[model samples]
Target: MGIHIIKMPDIGEGIAEVELVEWHVQPGDTVVEDQVLADVMTDKATVQVPSPVDGKVQALGGKVGEVMAVGSELIRLEVDGPGNAAAGAKQKRPVERTETAAQAEDATAPAPVQERGADAHVATPGPAQVPIKGQAGQVQPAQSQPQVQPAAGAGHAAARPAGEKPLASPAVRKRAWDLGIELQYVPGTGGGGQITHNDLDSYLARGAMGSAAAGRAAGYAPRDDEQAVSVIGLRRKIAEKMQESKRRIPHFTYVEEVDVTELDALRARLNAQWGAERGKLTILPLLARAMVLALRDFPQINARYDDEAGVVTRYGAVHLGIAAQTESGLMVPVLRHAETLDLWACAAEIARLADAARAGRAAREELSGSTITLTSLGALGGVVSTPVINHPEVAIVGVNRMVERPVILGGAVVARKMMNLSSSFDHRVVDGMHAAEFIQTIRGYLECPAMLFVE
Candidate 1:
């Protein structure tokens, strides 16, 4: 067998490094050509690394969450015939130390001494050691182990005398304490009468600890489990972007209530009429049209701000950003040339871009270069929100949920479908008065739905 090495490829945009997000294959896993071996993150997008040649994975260069530089070794594989790597070259990969592996031997050790009827037997605790896999793929015990006390349920002793401390590892003790379990009264089943994790589980499972335990058996068990998820990939990118936006820009938010009763009615009528010939329309397309028309009077809102250069660019063409929530995280996909598209066309493009973003299939160009962003939580949109401006963009308009509420219209209590527009702007570029005027303009078009089609 020959050795093959796969190095991290440079994922364009002059990026010097990428964070290792996920691994599709591990050592001993057989991978076929064109199969994705790993996923690495560059900025916000995830790029998959596919295997070029069919081979068995020998070793991984780095663990997940490790930021690897370009051209660094990613994975090592063994294939037939002479591979690209030298036959006798030593592969240098970081060894991973897992919590389970550190406690593996302790979990497997023999139980402690016990008294049987009239006779008593003494069981000695073995030396603490951890097993580590050697380069030769052999298991070797490492010397000078970290100090470890026996875990819970250590001994098979039927009963221990009162005031005698129960033998359990620190982890087990902490877990028991969290569960309000008194270890002294509990029996140990581990080596030398030590308490183990299993003993605690079995104890809880059997409902041995009276009323509170019985309540747990009846479905009120208190849990102390925690998961440590590393912030990487798209989530990391979002955090950084949000932090930068908040830190670098002075932000001001404006909110206005709009009577969208006519707008909703118009939408329903359009769907009813075009139900068979064209796709159904959502409230988004109308809003997009309104914003597009409104930008004519308020050019400052449809622009990008270069804070470092002290330049506020005003765009004649409306490039709208549709904020979408994906399985990975929040992503904003750009809807280019919004000024040119009508309501139906805008709806189609919005749906397409949202689908592409959610599926992680959106191209880089489709994700960037938005002049202004429109975000909505749809049915979940609450009464009010303080949206943050998309970095370098002067404004972001947020759509909130619409609800029917009683309103006094010409001395009559009329039920009106009212919605709120929550928008944010970079205070450094767009003034607060202009931001308010911008939202009011959209409101006028929305309340008077026919004006959306006005030339």
Candidate 2:
């Protein structure tokens, strides 16, 4: 048998360290070539580490949630012939171990114990035979005691005999007291009718912990369960990004309601005329068109801010980012050059990007380089929202749920489709008046509908 060592490879973009997100193999498990050994996370991207040679896993390099540096040992395997451990010994030298690590290693090492036969001594649910800590911090097994079998018909815990004194150990008595169980009502399964821990467990497991609790409604039963989930991988990156955006930038939000009855009618007309030849249209593509034309007048809203360099770069081409909710989390996939595509083309590209993002197939390039962002919650969109600007970007526009309500027009009540635009901008770069004006310009294109087609 030969030893093979695999080191963490450098994923590009000058990343020096990556967090170990998941492991596909454990020690003693045989793995084949090209099999994924582990999953590591760098920034928001996840990369899989594959085994180059078939081997049995000897040891894992790190635990999940550990941030390990590039070139660190990832795994050790046992292969058939001479392995790379000997050839690359100098290049992949073992890391220096600290005193704490040595002690931890020794503490987890299994101690030698003799195996017992089935007919020998059987372990009971009591303090006896349980391991206890000695004065030297060493574990010592408690002395064994005599064992007794429960009655053949002891499936249900029967009440003790009327005049016979109930028998039990001090430990069992204390546990019964804690559970508010009376010893006289419990049946003993030990010698001389002594109640054992197993009897108490059986009573609880049979849904009869106590008469009063059993009679209570199941919906109101007391529960003592909890779960702890570790925040790692893409979730951690999102948390960090949101925190950075909130901490560094001063955000100001503006909201405006628009009458979209004419816009919806226009969309229906176009979809009806071209539904067979071209793709159907959604409000998103029309909104994208409105934003594109509006940006021509309000160029300041479509820009990125470099706080460290104290520079703001505005782009002529609108690379719009559409926020998408995926199975994993929130992701923003960019639609390059939204100003060039018509309504149908824009809708097709938006759907394609959204599908790619949801399926976890969005490329890194497709996820970045957006001048501004647009976010919508579809039918779940509520009255209004205060959306956070994507970090380094000046603004983000949000769409709310559209509803038809009564409105007074021409001194008469009429129903109109209305929606609200909730948008936020960096207060350092954009003034309140300009922010409101930008949304008003987009609202103009949307409310009029015909203006979107004009030059």
Candidate 3:
């Protein structure tokens, strides 16, 4: 029985340190070659590092929320066949998961994973959060105690045992400390007949605590202004990136609204036909196809300007990025060659890319090398947004929700589907006319969806 040490590999562009996010397996659990060992966040990306060889986990690195450098020890393993820890030192590894328990868990970036199993205790939830009863976002008080079963869509909280009264809300019981009261003893009047905050205050008024020891038993209450939090993986990365993009770029933004009635109906029909076999044919794929066609008419919009050289280098092929929200932060995976693919092929490929990005199954190759990017905050509609350009790409297109509004066209009042097309381009390279032209061209393709398919 020998051990193999797994180290963090380079998963992003030009990053040295990675914040340790998660460990998918523990000691004695069988893992195949390419199985994800952990998720890590670097300056450029939040990436999943996979196992290099088939093995059993032996040891893992730091607790959740620890920052580790590239080449840092991640996991120690025991292989079934002939291999040793020292032997793994010379092996080349690519992050891939050979064994999967199910679809990968989608958490914002990976959480600092604690050990798993019968003995494994639950890690407390993040701040501004009460401990959810079982998992995320849902908090219900213990059933044994008299507590309210929340109304539909209402947040429910659980009760604490008699002696261990928490100092926070019923929601804070597991994550923080319970709001100091013997929840079990409190009689109920709320739904499902559970006790609420008033009940606890009533208990306290009726002499619940008499000693400083009782206060200590509750939870440590800090000074009002001081919010103590442990900064980890993706959150830390977001802080760093926001600072970088703001400091470096001299940015400019332009926005316009367009008629998208035809485009919307077209995608809806296509989705109805093929969504089950292929993932839903989203608005994003249609937008990508339109952007590619528009880019062809005004080539300058797709070109990058080198400030130092004072030249614009137009890319020959379109490597378009689709900004997607993931477990980590926003990731823009490239839908390479967006110009060549037909609508269905584009939809299928983008679906695969999004699934890969969400599961952390995306290879390093899938993330980089893009000429331009598109982003949509689905259902989050705000008029005219200024998006930051993904460096090296001269521009990024932002899409807002499509809404139907009344319009007087050809002297007739009628309803039409309308959506705003927002673009952020490098002023240093792209002039306002060129950028507007590009948007107008995209608007035309959207207005006439069949015209986009013709060429």
lDDT tens readout by residue for model 3, 1-455: 56677777866567777776666675567899888777776655567788889888655655456677778777778776555566435433322232211122222111121222322222222222212122111222211223323223222333444333323333423222233333344445556555455665665565543444245443453212111234556667666665665565567788999999999899888879877876677787788888888888777777666666777789868999888788756777888988888777888888888898888777667887878889888789577788888876688899988889998889999999999988888877788888888888888889999987776
**Using TM-score as the measure, which candidate wins?**
1
Better of 1 and 3 by lDDT: 1
Model 2 bad stretches (over 4 Å): 87-215
Sequence-dependent TM-score of model 2: 0.74
lDDT tens digits, residue span 1-455, model 1: 89999999988889999998887876778999999999888774778999999999888888776789999999988999899999678776643434334465453242222222212211222233334332212234444222223234433332456434468776676566546565655678999899888988887676655553434331343432222345767888889899999999888889999999999999999999995677889999999999999999999889998878888899999999999999878999999999999878899999999999999888877889999999999999999999888898989999999999999999999999999999988888788888888899999999999999879
Each candidate structure's count of clashing pairs: 21, 0, 22
The runs of at least 3 residues in candidate 3 whose Cα sits more than 4 Å from the true structure, single-residue gaps closed, are 1-17, 24-37, 41-231, 268-280, 305-311
Tally clashes: model 2. 0
What is candidate 2's lDDT per residue for 1-455, written digit by digit as tens?
78899999988889999998777876778999999999898774678999999999877787676789999999888899998776435433332223334553443222111123311221222223433332212233445423222323334543744434457776676565546444555677899778899988877676554456444453443322122345676667778888999998899999999999999999899989997789899999999999999999989989999999999999999999999998667888999999999999999999999999888778777888999999999888899999989989999999999999999889999999999999999999989999999999999999999999999
Q: Which of 1 and 2 is ahead in TM-score? A: 1
TM-score of each: 0.78, 0.74, 0.63
Give the clash total for candidate 3: 22
The number of clashing residue pairs in model 1 is 21
- State in Å the error of residue 95, model 3: 24
